[model samples]
Target: MTERLRRALDARPRLTRWLLAGPGAVAAALLFAMAMPIWLPKGAAGIDNIVFPLILVPLIWAVVFVYACVEESLLRCVAVICGTAAVCGLTAAMAFTGWI
Candidate 1:
């Protein structure tokens, strides 16, 4: 079972790399941005939380994408991206549920 899983994971390196660098990074970045408002200060004008995330989205995406592209271990790369997305997603969910 483990061997089959390993073979599947190793089957198409290029596709996996592209998937991680593209949609995976985008999803993580967007989730992080969405969760940012929960933690970011509202600033004097009370718009920083909104503005900052919008401004930082591209930078966030680029950084995640680059890391996914350059990381040596694919497992580690997936873990990092998925972990980030999961954390941010949970944060957003908690906020919506008024748990935070």
Candidate 2:
């Protein structure tokens, strides 16, 4: 890894990094699952009743974009919002599917 990357990784404890990264990773996984129907082969079991938060993506992006336009802080609000939204969306989807 580059020195900068290594330093960034080493600055945070393993557990802290995992906790910080977990939500985004889970969101990415859920997003991928939501997109799987496009790749599933014919005659395979199909996805049903998916409650995708497609609207949330744009809404969050707009919020972030607006914040970016005026904010000077180095905070990572975009990741926070996206991660939280992902968790909420996934949980809602699961409940809607009777999986929760």
**Candidate achieving the largest TM-score:** 1
User: Each prediction's TM-score against the native?
Assistant: 0.84, 0.35
Candidate 1 lDDT over residue span 1-100, tens digit each: 6566546657877888889998999999999999999999999999999999999999999999999989987767777898999999999999989999
Show where candidate 2 strays beyond 4 Å. Answer: 44-100
How many collisions per candidate?
Answer: 0, 0
Residue 34, model 1, lDDT? 93
- Model 1 regions more than 4 Å off: 1-8
lDDT of 1 at 79: 73
Question: Local distance difference test, per candidate?
Answer: 0.90, 0.47
